[model samples]
Target: MSNATVRPLGYDLELISTIYISHSKNSVLPLLVASLMVNDISIIAIDGDHIDDVRTMIDIIQHLGAHCIQEKNRLIVDARDLQNFDANIPECSSTRYSLLLLGALSARLGKSKVALPGGCDLNRPFDFHITCLEAFGNEITVDNRSITCIQKHSPKTEFSLPYPSVGTTLQAIFSTVIGDSRLAIIIRNTALEPEIDDVIAFLNKAGAKVFRDDSNITVIPVGRGSLSAVSHEPIHDRIEASSYAFAAVATRKVVLLKNCPVKLMTQALTILEQLKCIFYIQSEHDILVDGRSIEESDPISVVTQPYPGFPTDLQPILAALCCTLKAVSHIRDEVMPHRTGYVKELEKIGALISSDGNKITIMGFESLSNAVTVNVSAPDLRGGMAIIILAISNGCDIRIESFNQILRGYSRIISNAHILGGAISHEHP
Candidate 1:
């Protein structure tokens, strides 16, 4: 857990008006790790709203001898003095992003011992990352606790991922950037997430040659000591923006999401339209979602896919919204099979939800009969958001525990909810 303070949500929270929210910290954290490959200072200007959530990654990099300073929205990272390559500490195990360090560390220091990562219980294995590193001529040993990798003299020139995993794709690119300048590494079937493109743009700006063609990515290795300092601002978080949109629709409120990336949210917007929610794209970056008149629609059937498709991250949020409708909804998450852990949590608060493997069946009710004050716990990040949305939409006097999990992905959630006329507060002991 981080040193940042967390306060649970009080009872009977309701979002009754419009609210404006900032971007998330998801896209910028990877860039921060990429900055470590540079021998010079790299400046990253992140949205201040969720900057506190980035402290875990900064602390992990600092443990590896990188000097990182956070000043409001701006982060200054100096990796010229990085001396530690072993990332077996607790911080590395806190989030799965630490797995990216295997490539960065091995490329810079020749070897890395990274503990197995821990995050949401999404049933995602680390074999994809291991396969990518092993293809790069890195001898890897995995045990119950950690994975150790040592680079060999001759690295493979090409590899292909069995699945389009975003983490494995990033590991392959980072490991290829600074080793064997004569080799041009090719990675096929890579994830086409916008964040991957953001990382590629950042790397290209910092003197790395990385290109993408459809599902394949090519990284032309630059010689050691080639990367230079660069400043980058990551694109807005599409998942965060969609979360707010779902919240608006669930609570029947009008919310104007500022600095939202509307283009990246094609599938989500399409689904919202199906739900009869109104959207006014104020500009390329702003959207006004009016959900005050949401009507009963047909049953919704959604399948989670990669970029440009229905996102698995938003499945929980959508599931929560479906619980309030008069029709049944089915959500299948092919990406993360075990993502339905929150179904039980939602059921605790009078929601009719059931899970069978990766598929979730939501028997929507016309209205919730809230006769008692119920307390529920957040199972994970996205799942927690789902529970909160359901609680507010029903106007149930529910107390939510483990809200810190929700804070991991969302910034200033309670304050933003309050701004939208939600009667929410910290749960005092």
Candidate 2:
């Protein structure tokens, strides 16, 4: 058995105290809609806090006519009071969640006009989303500015997605759950992400039948029944936990992350083990990481894939780690080619990096000078975190512009950093 006791680092640099990672936006948005579609008054109790994207999803849900009250992290939604079927989605609130709204709104309201959601400039095309929804009988028109959806008729229950796109898969499940009659949905080539499982669990708990297999998820109505209201808490943010883990390793500190769902982070933990990271799984809810031996590991090459693989979300942080280490490393972001743009920004902080297409080559440096006041633009969320880690590791206090990009995913940034003994602050310019 792993010992629960942990020792603090002797270095003057601050180490992370225990931290409770917030609920995942990826999990919360789907659960929010699943709860709303049950056609009843219900209280969806969210346990932990989340970022701006969760709030954006809530606003969209309210605009679609559900009366909702948000107290701290809990949302009390009254779906019976829905007045307007047409949804008015704001531009700033645009995200992949909009696609999920399309599925849920088409089932509940039958029509919606949602603006295209803005996110990291990954240049991910919406064609896959449009294709999957269109296959499910949702009349969708794709325009540069907005997407218009009208449900002409109930769709066929069977679907075989060309790719295991998480957004598309969720759209299928959300649309089918609230149909007028008994329906069965078979989603093949599904994304087996833990967040997807959380959605399935939420729906199943609320009187929907969802089964998971190797590469597919099947959803069936429970005894000719529509969805019912539910109260649920999203799983802890695995990406957030992984980010702090990488930070602990790179900074050579000891950190105990609270409520870290280690089972969901297997792939990431395997990679960390390869990096000579010493970790103790204290319990189902916590993990102790000692990064003192991180310098002993060999250079590693990583490729980003769907779940059960290295997450694309952590690729940038790993690249940042290569900067602080003594070995050359290669990171291939097969998931999003646009993620490589952050490599250019890291150059300003004295990283020897170059990119060719989707792959990034990092030539590790012996030493780096602190950047006193270099202006850095946050190209995306994970990229923004990468730059911040690079700056702090080099003993530099820097200002990052466009930091709201980070806020879309992470909450209480300055506060969390301060708790970890980081001298960081955020201000609007």
Candidate 3:
């Protein structure tokens, strides 16, 4: 291994291992397995560690239990996790964008649904499920911290969101009508992250009514019908891909991300612009990044909110970038509680970051001097990965714990580091 110390970040990192699920693909693996079991699908995760073996596993998923278990669970099903789509619940197959399920479930199933919103609090700016349901003539009443939607006269026949809520977007589309009918949904001041578009496109593939204007989306509802099974690969995840790219920037090293789509990373690219990081987007899949000349940028401001704004997922990496800069920077996480607030780990990396509710004020420093072991618990995925970047950049042995959350986002991060020219990996003893 390189001279760099093996500093892992996260509160629970010490206990977990580089899990070799061998037989099954992870990401949303657990969720898929759960879905398979509940639906009585004939799918099983084996103990094999190769692509060919996993393909066989998918063959089982292709034809199995016909029933789908729509029970509620706090599952993180982003599009990046699946090797292939779920055939039984193709509508629900792609978990990453599963928030779209809220609409269809409510309409045909009579609006009875429960599911956890993923990503940090910043991810959910507005709840779209309620908006579309009310517009569709569904009597949506708040039930003590829970929302209940009851269809009353097939809804108002018109739906829109003050903001484009994925949950709301789905609700509006499904509530169209039993037959062909025209409907409109207003998604004003709404941001459309590429991932949201993934689900919209999927619905369109299934022949759902969907039309979007500058800020509003007009989705012609596709009434209940056994839509033909559609097959299409999910777009490569730019968020996960860019995190590694940001890692290269943190260490001031050159890391080329192949199989990555550059168009989706415009927002992160813009912020990196402020840092003066040189990014060469050669092809659709290739992104080469070289950092500034070890020079610190002036103090800057980063507010992490919903899409179109700086992503909350990138806040941790940006915070790591802030630490390298010898200036004051502000990262305000306006969504979750104490999310970017976890800048305390930055203190371990030798940066000054303070938490005040949803806002974080970071003071850039020249360098965080050498330290024995920098131990910190990761509050979430990006935050956790950032600690790894901080360790690599500052030459510190950072121990990150609570990797369970981090793994939900990044797949085989250590492998990524090993493949790239950044840090070395070591199993915790």
Candidate 4:
């Protein structure tokens, strides 16, 4: 339609659709935390898409008495002149990453007062991070308003997390990387997410020694003046690439995702194959997906897990695609219970779906046709993207309220839709 190529809802595009996503939400926050650990000014040249979250981080940095200047994708952070360590998390800036600032500030400033971190209602708890900070020998107090951290002495050299949590592992690393040079922090049960590996590499390049031995991440602080300014490029967004692939499956188009990190997406690729979706790896960094002939087969089952397993982040989009398949599909999300909030929205447009707690079941439909106008609410980031997939698969007009929810994770989404020949428009109510 609209001169883009002719194909059924789930067919191959005549031309390859090239989409470039902005930097990852997982990368930007850690880079900001790394800047706080150093005593010297660090110039970070970052490239990515999520502008709102980036702006919020920059504001938090400025609030902490660090100077930041941005031009295009690069940000120059002048932390050499940092004066204040206390960060006030405004409601507009209530992101979960804001919690990591506590570890960075306490490591350098001796104390910090930060509001409780906020973000998409994912039911994420802070007890794991609290355990990491307590291992730093810091006195912590929590009230309804904010969290207070006061550093007292050198932290314990080793600790263990109740679960392999990325945030907690990062907290352990950030809080200890600024300790005495002789101190080595060992964390057991550390998360093995690729993003964490990239953050470790960035810190290592900045003069800190961070390595992995088995299931542990060890961080050794070289000294207060050890870090050196360095430019780093974050790994490509694996979640974004997977989202595009799922979109292609739902819409039945041959879409090409360029510059994808195929190595990190093995589980996603395996699930795609199970769905009877025709896809192939064009290269290590590219994938060509032919959704033209999705066959009705056995129901594909998915269980969300940490990295190297199926990612919890892409669960919603994949679930949306299940609605378009010929057989019933099942998804179990142990990471986030509310991740399926968009299912009701899909049902509004004629989808056969049911849920029990964190598990969801979707019965495929031959086609979904809606004559009446429909409006969907996006309560979270991934859920917002799910409804958009529904619109594409159903070939129906969908008005998404609070579209900004999707912006927190996706960059240039409207442009991406246009490039893929999707009819998506924004309206102010």
Give the count of colliding residue pairs in each prediction. Answer: 0, 1, 36, 7
**TM-scores for every candidate against the unseen true structure:** 0.92, 0.91, 0.69, 0.92
lDDT of 1: 0.82
Please identify model 1 stretches exceeding 4 Å from their true place.
Answer: 1-24, 51-53, 366-371, 419-421, 427-429
- Indicate which candidate wins on lDDT: 1
* lDDT score of residue 200 within candidate 3: 53
Candidate 3 regions exceeding 4 Å error are 1-100, 115-128, 139-150, 165-167, 174-189, 292-294, 334-338, 365-371, 419-429
RMSD of 3: 10.7
TM-score of 2: 0.91
Model 2 misplaced regions, further than 4 Å: 1-16, 47-49, 91-93, 180-182, 221-225, 366-371, 419-421
- Rank the candidate models, highest TM-score first: 1, 4, 2, 3
lDDT of 1 at 352: 86
Q: What C-alpha lDDT values do all the predictions have?
A: 0.82, 0.75, 0.52, 0.79
Please write out the lDDT profile of model 3 over residues 310-366, one tens digit for every residue. Answer: 776677787787777778888777644457545777776676777777777777543
| Cα lDDT, model 4, residue 379 | 68
lDDT of 2 by residue, 1-429 (tens): 776977895434355466677777678877776665667755665654557677777787777777888788688887876646555456433566766667776766677667776677888777777877787778888676678888886676777887887787887787776664466777789887888888887787778777888887777644323556777777988998888788777666677888888888887788678887878888987988876767543887999998888889999988887887777789998777678868878887777888999999988643455535767888888898888777767665667888988888778666666544467667865
RMSD in angstroms between candidate 1 and the native structure over all alpha carbons: 7.8
